[model samples]
Target: MATYAIGDLQGCYAELQSLLERICFDPTQDKLWLVGDLVNRGPGSLEVLRFVRSLGDSAITVLGNHDLHLLAVAAGLAKLHRGDTLDQLLNAPDCDELLHWLRQQRLLHAEENYVLVHAGLLPSWTVEQARGLAHEVESALRSDDYAEFFAQMYGNAPIAWSSELSGYQRLRVITNACTRMRICTPQGEMEFKFKGEVSKIPAGYLPWFEVPDRASRDATIVVGHWSALGLKVTPNLIALDTGCLWGGPMTAIRLDDRRLFQVGCNTPVAKDW
Candidate 1:
């Protein structure tokens, strides 16, 4: 059985199907590792959500920023953004069931020698710590009063991490680090403004994965959400988001062999928002 790690779907359902066909994926035997952001930005979001939800146990997805935004918007906690293409999904007959499944998804997934997250982890967070923090968010997301969690989940404050941090502050830091992070200072404080290619690397900041002495460095990290970083693979890091929603391709990597598979976007181009 093979395990494949897919990049952000971002509502590109046709591209996902095309990529799966290219891989000749056998759901009965192969497993899917999705890096989240499964909906938003492109057409076919409803279709994408329905198909991924149908995968059931064969699919594993972590929560991405956009995914969390969908949750908040659904609860009337947040408004739809200018570029959001989630209306079809919000109005789908299976909206509640699909969103329920999405909320139950984890923020981090670990197996063998790898950790899967929609974004990267704090450099201070070892794999063990990453798992625990992710569980904290998972618990909040799955709780009956998760609406309260969403209400407090939108800020970028407490950008720094601290084991001593508690309540929504702790959960928000963990959530931002795992879902919205791209760059950070050496001290593991997240930078929310920069989203261009690595050539435009911000002064005094490093890509989240490049932080020296990262505690999770021992484990290979599979990540998405930084489309500008574009299909980077190193001995320890694999970046799969290749800008599918920006007129680029959707990518998937076979975890066991490091084999790569991709399909160009079938949707119209959308410039970065």
Candidate 2:
């Protein structure tokens, strides 16, 4: 059986279908690894959610920032933002079930020598440490106090990590690092504002994948949060966000051979937003 790691779907249902067809994906024998952000900002969030949900155990999806935002909005802890493309999902009768499934998904998933996360991991964490930290957020999201957790989720507090951190501060840091991080200063300071190409990182900041002497460098990391980075495949890192929701192609990579399958977008993204 083969495993395929796909970039952010971002509600691009037709592109996802076409990519699957191009790869001849076999749900019966092959597994699909999604880097999450399964919905939002594209034309078919509902369809994407429904089809992936129908896949059941055949697909392993981790949580992306957009996915968490959906959960928060559904929980009445947040509001639909200007560019959010989740109205159908917000009004769906099965919204609760969908949100539950989304919350139950882990922030990081690793098997054999491959690791899948919606975004990057801090340089400080080994794969095991990242997984453990991910579980902390997953537990809070799945707990009945999830709404309470949402209430405390908006900050960048406890901005640095240490072994001694505990409670919401710890969980928020972990969540931000996994779901929203792109660049950080060597001192582990997050630079959330920069969204340019690799060459554009500020003097003191480094891409998480480029962090010197990263503990998890031995493991292949497949992630999909930075559309600005596009579809990049290096020896140990695979970036799958190809700006699918921004008039670019939706991307997918075959795990066994690293072959790429992509579909172009017809309409431009709602760029004005």
* Candidate 1 pairs with clashing backbones: none
Backbone collisions counted per model: 0, 0
Write one digit per residue (lDDT tens) for candidate 2, span 1-273: 888888998888888998889889999999999998999988788888888988999999999989988888888889999988899887888877777778888889999889999989888899999999899999998898999988888877776788898888889899999989998876677877788898888898889898888889999999999988888899889999988778888788888998888888766587776
- Candidate 2 Cα misplacement greater than 4 A, ranges: none
Cα shift from native, residue 92, model 1 (Å): 1.3
RMSD list, candidates in order: 0.9, 1.1
Best of the candidates, lDDT? 1
Q: Give the C-alpha miss distance for residue 111 in model 2, angstroms.
A: 0.5
> Residue by residue across 160-257, what tens digits does model 1's lDDT show?
99988999999999999999999999999898988888889878998988899999998999999999899999988999999998888899999989
In angstroms, give how far residue 272 of model 1 lies from its true place. 6.0
